[model samples]
Target: MRSFSRLNSMQTKLTLTFLLILLPLVSVSIFANYYSQSIMNEQISDRTKGALLTTLEYIDQLTQNMDQQTLLIASNPNIVDIWKGIENPLSPDHLYGIHTVQQQLTALTNVNGAVKDAFIIHGESGNGVSTLKGGIKWPDVKKDYWFQQTIKGSGGLVVYVPTRESRNPSLYMSEDMIYYMRLLDVLSSTREPNVMVLAVDKRSFQKIIQNLQTSINMNITLLYNDGFVLETNPNSENLHKEEPFSITVKKGEWSMRLEQPREEVFKLSHILQQFTYLITAISIMLAIWIAWLVYSSISKPLQQLSGAFKQFSSGNLAFEVVHQRKDEFGFVMNGFNRMAAAQRKMIEDDYEKELRLAKAEFSLLQSQINPHFLYNTLDSIYSVASSNRIPEISEMVINLARFFRVSLGKGRDSFTLAETVQHLMYYMRVQQIRKDHFTEEIELDEATKELQILKLLLQPIVENSIIHGLEQSPNEGYLCIRSRIVEDRLYVEVEDTGVGIPEDRLQEIIMEMDKITSKSYMSSPDKPTSLYYGLKNVKSRVKLYYGGDADLLIDSQEGKGTKVTLILPMGKEGHT
Candidate 1:
């Protein structure tokens, strides 16, 4: 009894399992059935259009053939013969009299074996016949509607007609579609008009429909320009005998439609609907699984990272995150630590750089004070020497006195043009006593002489020529000092016809000298540091007193000459 009970339980569980599987399978089958039906219906609709487009393309080709036929007939001289033969017909003087012409036009149509009949009709009189070898009773032009349309269709040689009665006596009892292509006889002296019609038997159009049916099991209808039904496939219930698919094809117009049974379409749709339900269920399960996986992988890391960031935000600059896994978060934590370390080092380096710059500036200012003391001591010695009355000593002492007096006039920084030139004269006299190689000329505008300038400015510039410039030159050189006031600035130019400084070195020297002594007075503090020491010292003092607007310009060339120009403010107060 216990065994029987266990077996019953197993059977019941198996039944429930099968029920679960079958329920889902049944649902999926229904959905798939409906979906497939919808898809097939849409595909069938599109295929019908594509097939119609193809049929239209072939019809267009046939129309092209008809157009060529009309043009050939119009242009051929044989057409004139056919017209002449028909005009005076004998009893047997049937269309055969024009057989040769028809044969040529048939050859011209180029429609590959599908030429059912070819004929021409006179206008509105019903007098027309086929030109085939055996004179067939040509289709009646007056009875056929295509003939009427050809007569009325807007006067172009290229026109086409639809299915109608055959003109050939061989096929007179059967129905056929034909195109009446108009022709103009060029050979006739009177310019006689002509009409040529190419007839396609109904059998040809039937075959086209049969081929389409064999390709796909669908019903189709071919529409005409006038909304007339050209052809209908079997099983096409919606396509009425007279009513077509509202779309029309003109002379060369063509269209097609497909009709599917409502019951079959609905059955297919039911199956497709079952398939959609299955896919939707699977997609929902997948979405839930993906959500769980994302939560496991991303949620924990984000929470920990948020905590670390909070700590860092509250002034914990050295905070480091502990992440064992090597991923994007790990890389981010590493970069944050490296950036913090680099930022601290940069701050420390900036402070050290500032301290060094301050010490260097302080040392430079200390060096500038010595030159002022030397100038004052020289002035005192000059006073004592002049009082002692030693003639040559007094003369030298007097030059020294004047040089120092001008040099000491300002606060070791700047002086006026008057003071600079006074210093220049004393230095020039000293140059004559020492080397005695050059004559000097001084020209100053009255207005510029009183301008404030750097003290001892021109003395060094003049001294540079006497020492390195003319002192070494074998030939005697001339020194000319000229001053003028222009544009509210004093301009003092010292030009010498001596061995000149090279162009490349001239700008370098001038730039080096322009640095304020308090700023860069170092390396060799005994004299102003640089190649052009005197010029640099004066330029430095000028900039110091005048706040950098003042400048010393040097223009020179190899072996030609040197011109030193001083541009300074016109007043003693400040830059104007």
Candidate 2:
């Protein structure tokens, strides 16, 4: 009661209120000056550094552009091919090669105005082609510093200043010039070691720093590796006392900095300090009023959430969700409170079990076999066919590439029958090319082509027909694939005129296909021993997804032929 009386007393209350207002105001005055100055300095630092980085990025991009331009010319198969013709330079093919190179360089210059000229300096012969007024050949440049630097760069790029005394200096003719040099692209593991130069004006970089300095009241400087100043924009102010903030430009030996005037930097902080005094009395009155509002709006929720935060920080999931509906504070409170409420309600073991189940399901999906071996085999064939220049072989290779691209499910898991037919068409073209051992035919109704199916659905079935069936036959084989919609059901059939399965063996396939309906899942421990690697695999999946609506029918005679029929429900089309 005595403590309560003391708090209620007017003298005590006024005294407490007076200290609360005066002490903070005094501290705020000093703190505001320091804090404002710190913030100002920090903002200037970030802006200056950001501007520096932007300039550096532009320069780096320009260098990369120049490098790309050089590669385009140096790797010009025409230029490399003409090396034989270019040995004499006066030969008809050499002149043609030179003319071709000139056209390429001229096009490059027309596209990018930043580049002055693109040239290739031959390593051994020392003669080369340049874009300066068409093409010009030069004498051996074994002693040139830029050429020496190119060799030192070791196929990478090097940026250097072109001097008046440097070789072919008159070609650039300008005082402000930068030379980006690199060795030629090593073709077929053989280092040609030719020098490629891209001459650009140094002003391209200076203009960047100049553009930046217009907005900022600071002096900027770009320096080379040996402390030589490359570019600078100086602001007229006392910068002697202000140490410049420095940043290193990546990819090259370069550095840049911004020097801010001490006076301009602290200008706002001084104004904020002076205004602080005028608002002291106003702030004191505001403090008394805000104290009452804070207790109701801020204090209670903060206390509740603070405890909850402490519980969370301590790794204990024992806290109630705050349920306030007043303001943004209430939104924050509710989020925490709901989490605390959920922590108590959720079943821990069940949640972990759910996660494990999801992961196992995903792992099962990821483990499914992909036809990469076929891709590698096709890639090898494509490479050989491409080099051999065999038109039929190349066509087969390209078709096989298209087939795999569609079957691999780049991302899509389902595609229309049109795409499926296109894939099959490529597969048949490839098999027909390898050897005309089989006459392949495909028939698909225009209306039924829009129906969708799983990727690589018919590949294994068709592959088996080609390999196991026709490859064994002494006579030319015949294979037919037909797709159509009938009686509101999608029917696909593969018929082959090759050695067919016996009745006993056909029954085994039927039994294997039957087990798919009972298992529901695709993979089984019995899968290895069973002959389900291809046909049964497909049948199981179709049965699993379509249930009783899907059917796989197999019929054969030991000497005549084999026919496999696949029936899927009509509504399964365009599932994705």
RMSD (Cα, Å) of candidate 1?
21.1
What tens-digit string does per-residue lDDT give for candidate 1 at 205-301? Answer: 5567556663233455565554434555555554444333232222356555545445443464655465676676675566556545554465555
Question: Lowest-scoring 10 consecutive residues by lDDT in candidate 2?
Answer: 521-530
Per-residue alpha-carbon lDDT of candidate 2 for residues 174-280, written as tens digits (9 for 90 to 100)? 55777777776535356565766777767777777788764355667666564434546454445566664333443366667656666665676767767986787
Could you tell me which residue pairs clash in candidate 2?
321-337, 322-337
Instruction: Report how far off residue 56 is in candidate 1 (Å).
Output: 1.9
lDDT (0 to 1) per candidate? 0.61, 0.69
Could you tell me how far off, in angstroms, the CA of residue 5 lies in candidate 2 after the best superposition?
A: 43
Every candidate's CA RMSD: 21.1, 28.6
Model 1: runs farther than 4 Å from truth? 1-41, 84-86, 90-97, 105-111, 131-133, 136-144, 154-174, 184-193, 214-217, 226-232, 235-252, 262-269, 274-576
State how far residue 521 of model 2 sits from its true place (Å).
Answer: 99
